[model samples]
Target: MPEAHGTDEVSDARPGPIRVVIADDHALYRQGMAIVVELDGAAVVVGQAGNGGEVVDLCARLHPDVVLMDVRMPVVGGIEATSRLHAADPRIRILMLTMSDDESDLFEAIKAGASGYLLKDLPGEEVADAIRRVHDGQAIIPPGMAATLLQEFSRLSQAGSVPEGPEPTTLTDREVEVLRHVARGMVNREVADALGIAENTVKNHVRSILEKLHLHSRVEAAVYAHQQRLVPPDA
Candidate 1:
């Protein structure tokens, strides 16, 4: 087992690396994560915290570009830590790394300001990719989890729980086209190339769509599109 580093800060102020912190209670998992993150050569593990309280403290101190937070922890837990961190600085992007697929956990994490949720069993490379994507302001949900998200949305809608504010304006024709591709799980680059537009343009459209629809992430947007039948199942 790799030696567990104490709660001191680890800084990587290098120009290119995406600064990150891993917050998992398990020591072995923390060591494994450090290796996985460093393998990318573009991300540096700035700190490691063993519980949610440490997670909040490390995040407040390190101010990493991304935080790989484990959902189940003794002190505060990932959901509460994420909420506190976001409340402190809304710009802090949190990508939940967990083992469970419980729908309640997924929904709560999202509600707590987690930008992305991914299972722990994902490949190391995929986890690295998710970190990059989330740092770039994209929401990440593991494949096959979209259906779960949709079911949650349906439940909320049935409970007469409208979104926090009034319903946002509808999408434009071109935005709808972009959303259709998004609903099919196409990333921004894929959607842009498919539409013959720049990737940045696709990003803009997605941001606008999220704002207009008052949705949280691409997963939510895709689920909403499906719930409203904007993009049919066979489309």
Candidate 2:
């Protein structure tokens, strides 16, 4: 069961709200989640998919900013779909929003290029917040798995298997610090507070980090941070 601590209503002042695609094997669950996800008008469900294949096709035709994917489905699975979608368009953020809490599923999803993994039983508001957060370019790993992810990242870093991207030296010291916080899953506001800077300043630094690193979102930046050994890959 899911919880809802806060009211669902929210204000989205952006010219266009976050575009989302919900892919799940269960129709009823999808229907219910769709309501919660769009309750505040912060996100719009541009498409609903019964499986990973449908999502891939939908994405090919209708681009969405975030994808709420299920781990297990017929014809294709979320992990494989994530890989295909990422290969097709690295800009789309794939989040494994499933019922599975298995460590393998969690690790595999990230390996497949998913920005985050979340259980369906989280609060409704939390779910909504996640859609917005990932859309804003921040990673969202489950709390239980953060430490383990860091360990694996460290192991991979030591093994020299992390993917190659812009070197950390390409970014200034502050941008690198901001990237470090982002890899640790800190939002702009949180990062600002930590660094004793304004939120807008943090946002600027983040934008610069993306541009300099040739990355699309904070999720990718988190991967970069780990590739450069910045963070455990975070909160």
RMSD of each: 6.9, 5.0
lDDT of each residue in 1-235, candidate 1, tens digit only: 1111111011122347889899899999989988998897979999999988998888888888888999888888989999998788776778888676553688778778788677787778877877776666667765455557666765775565635432324678899898888777677778989999998788788888877876667767766776566676555
Worst 10 residues of 2 by lDDT: 4-13
Candidate 2 Cα misplacement greater than 4 A, ranges: 1-14, 100-102, 179-195, 216-235
Q: Against the correct fold, how does model 1 do in TM-score?
A: 0.78
Error of 2 at 6 (Å): 17
Error of 2 at 227 (Å): 5.0
- The TM-scores, one per candidate, come to 0.78, 0.77
Candidate 2: the clashing residue pairs are 184-234
Per-prediction backbone clash count? 0, 1
lDDT of candidate 2 over 139-208, digit per residue (tens): 6766666656666755676688766687788899998888888777677788899999998888788878
